[model samples]
Target chain A: MELSVIGKYKLLVARLYGELDHHGAGEIREAIDRELMRRGVRNLAMDFTNMGFMDSSGLGLVMGRYKKVSAIGGRLIVCGMNNNIRRIFQMCGLQRIAIVADSLEEGMEELDK
Target chain B: MNKMRLEFLSRSDNERFARTVAAAFMLELDPTVEQLSEVKTAISEAVTNAVIHGYDGSEGIIVLEGTLDKNAVKFSVIDRGIGIRDIEKAREPLYSGKPEMERSGMGFTIMEAFMDSIEVESAPGKGTRVTMTKTVEAEDEG
Candidate 1:
């Protein structure tokens, strides 16, 4: 997982790589949580741009992030879901919680507003 | 008839491993993304149930066999674990032999939803075997 930040207000963009199963969710949860607090990031955009696979554990990651952002008086947005990952989002109804978009620009656009 | 067989040690990691193999094997079916996801998810649910519920987290062997039968694909997950007492009851929604694992008890339901045909054969004190078949039937322009 590679994480980078750009733009003012310091948006934390996490580029997830590999499968998001239970075997790997613990690291992801801790990684994302640490970054969220360390960066003091309010508006967050998770770029699944490089993510190849995700399961229920991955869905839990998204849900946990949503709760974190809500607690901080911030907003959460996720983008770059491929066809495979998008199907999971739709199946689990995670789309309703996070703003899914075509690209990072679109996601950031929604988050900025 | 082309065949591919993979055997994985019954472990949590192997559950995702089974789903990966199933997804790749179904590639030639030219399945829609939704269709492919269904297959993968169904396989995941079943494999998890077998290892977690049937075997009760004990060490075992799981054999995943894939066969290309004409226009259809036949895949079977064979597990040598404590078999289900009732096949019909097992297939019912919210019926799980193990609930402490937080299992949704929807394993068979999801598998049935994805595969065209599913068959289970087991005997008391004998291991259970669950076989699933999916045929990509051509649509008619009626």
Candidate 2:
């Protein structure tokens, strides 16, 4: 999967393109963590608009990232989930830990709150 | 009934390959987009379980067998690797044998949720086989 990370002020928006599977989550995790550790970057917004497929592995990726941001006293918002992804999130209870937004703007707004 | 079997290495890269092949095989059934997605997710979870837990970071072989009937599909992901010692415990949500690997441990749960029926058989040092079935009702056309 290809990932584009843009950090502005305290929020980092990482948009993922392609599938989020075990094969791809590792690289994506490292890339996102690298940006999360950057100075002054506190909140994280993961954009899934371009992501076509995801499985339980993606759940692990999101849960792990949530732990990281929580450790730093920051929060994580996941946006642009398709119906299939929404079902997975609901099944895995990811919505309880991370903010689930309908769009990137909504997620950023939540982060700002 | 139509049947196909695929054998591939337990490498992470083949995860997508396995999902795509399963999707293609179920096309003859004309599954709905949601059904297709659910089946793909179930297959991915089973295959990934074989790759990560079954092989445990070691290279092994995984066999995906698919069969199609009228409006129904069955898939079996077989792995000749280390088997789960406690089947009941492993099926629990958020139970990962390799937590350090960042596994959500929802693989079995996802497969069970997305499929109509699931059966698992394994013996330690022998192997494990996960069989799942899903029926896709034809959508009515106005």
**Against the true structure, what is each candidate's TM-score?**
0.71, 0.96
Instruction: State the lDDT at A93 in candidate 1.
Output: 65
lDDT of 1 at B41: 69
Cα error, candidate 2, residue A31 (Å): 0.9
**Model 2, span B40-92: residue lDDT tens:** 99999998889988998799999999999998999999999999999999999
User: Distance from true position, residue B111, model 2, in Å?
Assistant: 0.4
Model 2 residue A48 lDDT score: 91
* Colliding residue pairs in candidate 2: none
Q: Which 10-residue window in model 1 chain B sums to the lowest lDDT?
A: B98-107
DockQ, per-model, please? Answer: 0.15, 0.87
* Model 1 misplaced regions, further than 4 Å: A6-10, B1-5, B24-38, B48-58, B78-130, B137-142
Counting only residues 3 or more apart in sequence or on different chains, how many pairs clash (N, Cα, C under 3 Å) in candidate 2? 0
